[model samples]
Target: MTYYLGIDGGGTKTYALLTDDCGNVLGKGVGGNGNHQIDHALAAQSIRKAAEGALNEAGLRIHEISHTFFGLAGADREADYRILHPLVQDIGFTRNYSIDCDTMIGLRAGTNRPYGVALICGTGTNAAGRNPAGQHVQVGGFNYMYGDFGGGGSLNIEVFRSVIRSWDGREQTTLLTPLLLNFLGYDSVRDMFDDFQDHGKHVPVHAAKLLFEAAAEDDAVALEILNRQGVELGKSASAVIHKLGMEEDRFDVVLAGSLLTRGDRGWIRNMVEQTVAAVAPNAAIVTLATEPVVGALWSAMDADGHAVSQDVYDKMRVFRNFEHIKHQQDKRL
Candidate 1:
């Protein structure tokens, strides 16, 4: 009769799942942006809203939940914990709850093995790893400024960089300039730049999809961009694998985030696989097919010395369209 709560607090939307001791998900809820870096107070409200919805649907109260686990964006560093701990406490968990960066849950979500590497390349890039010894490590930046690569944000920035470079004659002409112009319905680059400047708008993250289109047309520039992205992703994963001394270990390389999950093993994913193979030949690549909150819940179960089965994972399929949620929900208005 004991119930557990698991939350995935992300930049786009927050998801909460409620389940019993047996790992059968009873209820799930969706809420707003839960990245505390955007606005901690508001983000806390989002988490609370999601948790409440899940609890309500299950006809259970917070008091009845035995444990709560939060895998949250912006829970990256000690400073983040200082800010997030108070917020999580404010959301009604006075004690007996656990918190970690969302990447940890993504790692657990992708594989049944307890130890492996995780490479995330969706809106942003992050790398993490765990070993059989229970040791864990996270490498690279939480944002592009930290030299992170291979995510939609960095890819979007690169596309514009190529456009500006080609326009100024610093680089050869690229399809990105014309493709972006047509995509945005602009006649010229000047108009596109002007419109963005006037509105203080940057390229949207989803625009990264253009790389695939350009590559499909055999655009050299786009192909190069994607290839480099894949290599960088592999290098990041390699670093974590070495740090965890897992290079010789046979483990799963969990690929999550929109960039790798979508498409048919595009340039980036292929290059990543090649690079990881050079470093960790024993590693097998796999995509995360479930919502990451499943990992948050499974991690809690693991902590309590319970073995998670494939049947549990099969119940954790993403219930909603993730890309659609990222694009349409939790606008920062």
Candidate 2:
């Protein structure tokens, strides 16, 4: 009756899943943002809340869990680990746990093989890959100032800058100008620019949806932005493949994150697929066939020396798809 915990702590939300040694899910809970880079207090709060909720739903106490795996955002450096490791430990609920970047879980979500690549592009972008020889390499995840781009935040900033340029007559007129103005409740682009500059007003993350909507309408500017982002994501994956010496080796490249998983827009995914195929013709692109948290569960089982069967993996996949459908339906309501 050993229970394990798996957590996927991301920029926008955190998810926790409780499972038995046989991979049967006992309970699932979700909570607020857990990106340590944004706010440490909030991240810790989210991690605790989600984990507690899952434990309660499973009718179990935290001390009963045998092992826990946390895949968290902003855990790229040793400093980050220093901040997160103790925070998770302070929960005082689990006997053993491990923490790593969220990308690791995304990688595990795609393949059971020991070697492959993962690219995440949601609130931020990052790339990680492992070679068959156990060597690992990573790219991006340095934040915007460090030349990182091609995530929701980057896309929003670019669209905002484009609106400012359009207002200043520095760039061609774009549908984004009016769309953003309306979305922001501004009567004029000048007022919006003034508010942004003088008042520090920021565009919402959901503004990314507008960009994709415009692109779907064949807006040249919006399409170009998405195209560039897709290429950038592809190049990041390509860099990881080259570093891992998997250029000719067939491997799985898992694609996850809000922007890449957007149901209506296949252009971004297509661009990435085309770009990667040009370099690594044999690489298989996996579109998050299961939730990343499931990977955490698999890792947890592996750590505890439990046998994981293909039947269990299939069951996890089915459970994830059901959860996804339920989430979408709830959103509509």
Candidate 3:
């Protein structure tokens, strides 16, 4: 029984799935932060731990696996490749593995087609485009230094800045002022700003939801922040589409990440949909409908030259999440 391994390594957690030739999951495992950009040692340990746990559960040795594909965050540049190449190779698969940006996994997971654009609107913004000829191009996700913006994290800080701007008389008072103060239980903007100053500059990523709440109440400031963010995300996607010469191509602009999947339909998400439609007239926007790691599995199968069938995807859908997958081990067991 040939086995395949798929791993999605991200900053928050690492998840790995082991499957048989038919895409029937054998076992799944998870571990800690796996973004090598944060800590190479931690990422390496996380990947190994997750992969080993899955292998142990499936009672299979690394040698028994036919192929492995790792979709990893923080794999944006050549330096990242240098770090990840040796890191994954240390897993001892005899080189039967493939490495690509984690966004590619989102791309594959959200769309049935092999080629299209993947837009990530999470803690940070990033995008990747795949053309029919198998060419790949990535833009943004390099942080502010690289002109990246329009993710949940970006929204979080921008909200605070908006509050500061209102206080400085640069902008009119916004619902965000009261909404944020109430949400965090701060007595006033001055107190909140002082606390942020003394504690740390970083705002909690969850605070980004406040923007949507304020926008829902018809707050102009909140709406502006959201519009700018949506435009930024759309701009990133548009850049990728044009670079790949897929502007006129009919394809799915797969949307993944916390913000787009759950945020306001009339704002950020709608803006992305509109942007894709204007640039790529035939491009349709769709939220990721499967566990992202399933894309990792599909990528592995594709990289190994195996045909990916509807049945294969159907079998993998059983992988909803790490917890869900663990609860439903193979019935044959």
How high is the CA lDDT of each candidate model?
0.81, 0.83, 0.83
Clashes per candidate (backbone, < 3 Å): 0, 0, 0
> What is the lDDT for 333 in model 3?
54
All candidates in order of lDDT, best leading: 3, 2, 1
For residues 210-310, could you state the per-residue lDDT of candidate 2 as single tens digits?
A: 77878878888888888888888888999988888888988899898878766427667888899899889999988886788888878777778876789
Poorest 10 consecutive residues of model 2 by lDDT?
A: 317-326
| True-vs-predicted CA distance for residue 19, candidate 3, Å | 1.8
| Model 1: per-residue Cα lDDT over 140-159, one tens digit each | 74776676876776788788
Candidate 1 clashing pairs, residues 3+ apart or interchain: none
List the RMSD of every prediction in angstroms.
2.9, 2.7, 4.1
Write model 3 residue lDDT over 125-218, tens digit each, in one string.
7899898888999998778877988676677888888988998899898988887888788998899989989987677777888998998888
RMSD of 2: 2.7
| Prediction 3 TM-score vs. true | 0.88
Model 1 stretches astray by more than 4 angstroms: 182-185, 317-333
